[model samples]
Target: MIKEAIYHRPKDNFAYAYDKETLHIRLRSKKGDLTKVSLIYGDPYEWNDEGWKNSKKTMTLEGTDELFDIWFVEVKPKYKRMRYGFEIKSNENFLIYGEDGFIEKDPKNAHFYFCFPFLNENDVFNAPAWVKDTIWYQIFPERFANGNPLLNPKNTIPWGSTEPQFDTFFGGDLEGIINNIGHLTELGVNGIYLTPIFKAKSNHKYDTIDYMEIDPQFGDKKTFKKLIEVCHENNIRVMLDAVFNHSGFYFEPFQHVLEYQEKSKYRDWFHLRDIKVKALPEANYDTFAFTHLMPKLNTENEELKKYLLEVGKYWVEEFDIDGWRLDVANEVDHQFWRDFRKTVKSVKPDAYILGEVWHDSMPWLQGDQFDAVMNYPFTQAVVEYIAKDEINSEVFKHKLIKLLSNYPKNVNEYNFNLLGSHDTPRILTLCQDNKDKLKLLFLLQFSFIGSPCIYYGDEIGLTGEGDPSCRKCMVWDKDAQDTDLFTFLKKLIDLRKRYSAFGANGQFEVIESAKETNHIMYSKKTVEEQIIITINNSNSALKVHLPFDISKNESMNLWDNKPQKISEIEIEPLSFSIIKL
Candidate 1:
């Protein structure tokens, strides 16, 4: 017969109970253990400080090993939650407890931090409906400009270097961003997603060293306040890039973990495998797995989960930022996100959560984690079909149509549609600066669906490919750009804001058009308006008869206000159109 060992109860910790809910309680041993674990919980007022002594009797399950992965118990009263942990007793096992003699966290053993109730038939929706058709612009600080010469970090080690790389920091700050809101407004962008601006060791600032403060390299808190002030004034919302998955080696959170490893108060915030002692490792500490400088956060630790939730809440509540673009969201534990979402939203009801997922985000959108992802797959698909010589119009149309069909209705509306961004080549280079091709990509980009995004200089025709090249500073000189291209982008953006259909509630259809192949057309329609798009594939002008039943629906030219239309329209070689029907 197994006897129950000494234990403590948790408060409001039970996440679920049903006709017969099964509890999977996790625990660690501080003393002896060979087998068996039991759960105890109820009203502390009924059982008082003497609660554990008379804790309710539930079915006690048996198990070996020092930890309990599953221990089933019964809850007779629905909606009645109580505190609970576990106790273990055997020839060899340990029982971990808190200073209050309840359940203390053990840095040596991993624990699940994010928690949720089991799915029930009841409505489980958490997030709110957000405004669709948002227009976003990405700004790379140093590369963006020097609105203020005095605030420039240009002479600093990283910024002063002649070599243009991650180490180089240009002197862009909140002031620069605030100074540019009107510029963005004129460009017709509604939201601004700034790259990492938090205190960090790198100019790129992806590896955050501080979560609480704006990086001094960028500006101070007052500057950030001013940026927020100005952006909101112009009706442009801001989304901060939250890179909590990892931190720079010098990050204070990591430093605390290093100082005490498995023993530090902050030890539960990180992972430490086989260690020589409780102090910092003599050799440099481990990276997430050898990434070297970026230390992976251990979100699985319960103590750490509570800590991160607080950090995430602080930003939303304190700064009034619109939302967070969670970096590397896929690599982090899913539970961390579920809990993180719950906590952040609790502080701010309309807080938007966007995950950094390069692929399809169907999993995250299943009524839990994020509102949407960065839309990388869609960006690649759109770029390949329209810009690359290899992907034909037919193939591109199919991919585009299929992507729209797969995402949730609202998810598609809120998807971040970016073309040229800081990470990839400017769309100008991506399309080889081919005017016709660039126009086609732009038309589809602005009209097809989702929240449209513009790289800082994409509207002005800046050209470069990848990394250091893509990060070139924006050009304000009006005389120095491809004038025709600049005018074309401005025109499309103006049209984009004019159409309610751009919000993604419009009807859609596939017409015949061709790039590498022939016969491909993509179009959208709504009660208020209709848009027809066509791309001619061949090098020479081609006439495509309307498909068996397809006919031109527009009475007048949409984009150019061009007149003279016949039933059968001839498409210029490699040309496209946005005809209003």
Candidate 2:
């Protein structure tokens, strides 16, 4: 046995309450070191005539990465408490592992085993159930439409007339969205994640001037209220962006601090390196990415925290908004988010709290903070494999499997998955306008775990580079838009809704093919149905042999809703097929 290679922690992802009644435990051992492992667990308080009453359960090998094999098991202690230890067996050695150290035999004392004191229901991570079922549509308010042209800003230009810049506006507003709710409904999206709409200086609205009022460029308070009403009536949930991380340069308190310097009453509201605030050559205080216009807020300030907490509670309580997508969430203090969750969930218990965290987010997802973070790691891997072709099928699978193993299974279900957003290049441009590659990427995204999102113009095949280019006006003209791509997306969305296996929480399996390296096969299965999706990213047609027999079961093609009788299948070049069994 490789005693030093074995590792187990009593908290976090290693051992966590998967739900209210089930405790999930994970053990890591050196890859290829152990063939069989078993978990011996029982209520710590249970005592029998011999010693402590216990039960032994075999742990299944959940997954293996480059260096470790992860073993997992879910147990429900009768008394809602447990003391567990591992019994690891290799080809030539058998050893018992406990909290203290490895021993040749099982410990005589139960108290020495790893312990889960109690299964507290409140500690189990709980997100809004509706979130995982949602297909999110992200909209940049200024670029989506120009329904009420009269409300256009003074600098507003003709819609889609020019390539967008940092300061230009095309007058997309709440009224425009209200007029276009039918478009969203037809697209089959159930959730709308609008970029920051609170009063702000720029078109994107990430730099907030005021949190209580809607941006005049977007619309007034009453207009937004009507937009929410129409969205709910159409069964679409609305989530607004919260920019609590920083305030704009002209924000009241921030402006006051700039004028008075050391003597300002609100001096402590921001992190100032010097008493004199300067923005000409460089900023002397902390700001968002050194842009002096966006002054970072002191979230630790008690007064500021209370005010922001009210901001969180107000939107949900007043407008009945479904959730808040926090901006620059990682830079803020953890305690603020914990209180933010409490305040918002108090009024709307099922309200979703999604953070804009681009990296490892295990710290904020422990039930006390945000429900989920943006899954950028997933986005990076997909973009590299599908668009750049930087990694082959085998490498892609390994990277994806390793990423999925980082979090608990339940958290994976609610992760906010996206292909391209306001921050990245459009999907079409990323794939160099190859429609076949784009289709393959979409098939992979919709069939993968986590809630998926469509950036505003992506479904219509809009192509652009990064930053301002990615934030283009929505193409409403039928002749100019890619109608065929739009129709394909709608059909795929409909099928996703119809198939239980296509939804979040379905079991995922990667199937390896003996015939080709450019081919990839995966299946999503539920108790009611199973779906097998096969893809050919190469440019040549290939014959894909099934690893198992499927001739006995009735099979249908999910793309065209056509039935197919088969033993093995032929896949066209640069395309994918979804088979429902």
Most accurate candidate by TM-score = 2
lDDT of 2 by residue, 1-581 (tens): 78889999886888899888899888999989999999989989888778877788999887776688889898888988999999999999998888987888776568878999999999998999999889999999999988888888898899999999989888999888999998889999999999999888899988888999998888888998999999999999999999888899888888888888888888788888887988768998899998999989999999888989999999899999999999999999999999999999999999999999999899998889988999999999888888888877777776677777788888888999999999999999999999889888887788888889999988889999999999999999889888888887888788778887986867777776322457778888989998888888888887776665677777888777777677477888888888888
| Decoy 2 TM-score against native | 0.97
Clashes of 2: 0
Can you give the lDDT of residue 299 in candidate 1?
86
Cα TM-score per model:
0.73, 0.97
Question: What residue runs in model 2 are displaced by over 4 Å at the alpha carbon?
Answer: 513-516
Candidate 1 per-residue lDDT, tens place, 88-132, comes to 445554443332353333222212121223334322333444436
What Cα-based lDDT does every candidate model obtain?
0.64, 0.87
Kindly give the stretch of ten consecutive residues in candidate 1 with the minimal lDDT sum. Answer: 107-116
